[model samples]
Target: MKLAELAKELKIPTESFIKFIQDFDLELSECISTNFEVKDDFAKFARENIVFLRKYSEDLNQNKSIEDIAENIDQPKDKVAEIIKKDKPKLFDNGKYKSSVSSFGIDNKLGGNYKFVYNYFGKNTHLAERDFIGYRDLFFFVSQTLEPYLSNISVQDWGIHRPAGIVLYGPPGSGKIFWAKKIAEIIDYEFKEIKKYFLGISFVDDQKITFNDFLIQIMKSEKTLLFLEDFDEIMSERSEDESVKSDDEETKEIILHYISHFEKENILMVGAANSLEKIDRELLAPGRFDVLIPVFPPNMKERSEMLFHHMTEDLSPDALLIKILEDNKAHQLPFWLEISKKMQAFSNTMLIDFTQSLKKRIRNLYLKNNSTTIKITQKMLDASLRDASSKLTGTYLDQIQQFIYDVSLNNYEDFTVRIEALKVEVEHYKIVDEPTKPIGFTHNDEIKQKK
Candidate 1:
């Protein structure tokens, strides 16, 4: 029950499906993130696609005959028979369906979540280009590189060069998790998430079995997206000798047999981390989890957009409040955009939190009802912007910059080609004329002149 199969049944061409996927702007399940929007026509198209999918899954079960499926999908019986015959399905006596694209009777069923296995990480695909703001180039790089690998296009001549894995690395709150999900979604693969739930515990055997069950489910699918959050920590749990550490040779056997020798086709794995420097290099081998895609902080324009987006949310504003917001908008867009440029290292989370702080103040004022007018001023937003600025870049912006620069210069060899080129460009940034002093602080030369 792959998305590609669904597309074929609906007579949606590959190009149309690609366009369909690229038009989505999903609202994040968490409040910290937001989903902007797409055009009305695009939204209608996506909805129509989803409607067909739901109906197909619901009506094309084993109880239905070939004629029934044909009627349900609005296709001729001969075409339905052709699809079934190609599957080489087990024939029932009464011309009823037994098992094929729509059936899951072959799977062991321990992975009940895997039963609805057609599309995984379903929300990832619903991302519009503008949603990522400053990540257009990196987004294109990922999509273009992954296009051939996921589809059977490159398999004919370039099978040896298939991407085994992809990793997203950046500072915290830079939307690594969001990007990872989007990648899986765009590929139309089933996305299964695994977290470091068993951290700081010692039930090695149980944890190993649980992890294996996930892999077993992956092996059971046509194409699967396995998201291993904190992958470095997960790998660290493996013991060279499990018996000596946890008194279970079975756990040891599991690692040697199942984990180490894991080489699967048509399965793409993605990992996200704040600092990949601590990760073991062995796991990053070319045939393993190799590609590294950098997810950096938003640029000035993106930050400004983020600020605007968070400020203008799903609120039914009163007349007074609306006026205040209007004034805030008319007078403050340029000022906020300028301030955002100065807040260099600030992340998406920081900007969102600052906006949320403003929201909280507004909420409290409405709830308190102490004052007749809930008048909001630009000064309050100015203060929050300044505070968020200080919280991230602060007096050590140079230090953070240098740290990132040093890491990139040193580990450029470890990164994927696209990321390595970006790293090289970062390493080459000319720092000669720029003053290293923190903003609002006295420089050494200025102090000497004052003396």
Candidate 2:
């Protein structure tokens, strides 16, 4: 069933239903397909929970104060205010919360009985088989953008055509290339990277070829997804401060010429960019590279899971490391919670660095002690974290902030919670040094000046 059809049957607004799913942080792929087709499990869940859904929708549409919310949820006003403050909800003119201030979010935080929403799906058997660690929301968003390729109905009935080009924008090490490959996998396309040399007239297999010829050749063949790196630089709007290379101009022209035929030719081009700030406006027109997907770093929960996964991935049950992890409860999520919190804004690459450093440290410790009873200590964890923090520089944080701002302008509604959470995490790095006393200035002199 289409999501709209379900919403009609339930007498709920389709937009509200979508927001409800997002506010609850539900796994979107499980509830709805890329083309907004309602899954059987979600349909059942909605049917059974119609009463709850109606109340949530009603509350969601209202601009309520903390007192009103507290009264509605039967919680203490103080607690509700605290949660609201923590979440940093938008405010109305009269100091009431905006409709975007999710009551469902607050209720859930206050120990509301929403476990059924998650429990209905039961154990996620598919998650274990996933290629990447987290960002279920991002994966879902990418799937939706590719719905035209996945579903014929989306094209024929809804007029949703496959995007000719896509730009995956994010900070460095945020896994843009990983998602570009995932896009190809999702659409069952041949993954072909357009190397820099391919842009120029270059010899491939002793045959002279230009980028135009390469693109033509790919189009002539089966379905293909062409991945391009440094898209922001290559396709940047030509400005006096920055000169465009002749090759880059040619490449852009060729792409613009060929993009209109991409859908018909079974070709898709995905460009990886650090930011979209400098990309040419023409490139973002509808049916061109209009589909912009923002890849984000792992959140706190995902960070912990990733750490746990990396630590014990290939270890035997009886390995000394496993035993040590088990002894310290290091194999569990809680063991890594504090360290992962400190690793806020750290990219996937940085997390891997932390794991690698920690593993080498453990190896050295074992070599020195030759004991099976070694424990994973906080000192070792902190040392590994310091190594990872090398890459979490001030400039990287600024990039993350810029990415956050870009998403706020482009993809905020779809990823509100993540954007807000990341904003706070980035702010965590802000340092304020105490002002030092002026040289040769004594306390009595300061007191006299004050007098």
lDDT of each: 0.52, 0.83
Give the poorly placed runs of model 1, Cα more than 4 Å off.
Answer: 1-130, 157-161, 198-208, 232-265, 316-323, 330-335, 363-378, 386-403, 406-451
| lDDT for 43 (candidate 2) | 94
Per candidate, the number of residue pairs that clash is: 4, 0
Structural similarity to truth (TM-score) of each candidate: 0.53, 0.81
RMSD of each: 17.7, 7.0
Instruction: State residue 265's C-alpha deviation in candidate 1, in Å.
Output: 4.9
List, residue by residue over 137-207, the lDDT tens digit for candidate 1: 45655665565544454566456455667777676677878888888766667677755542223345555
- Relative to the true structure, candidate 1 has a C-alpha RMSD (angstroms) of 17.7
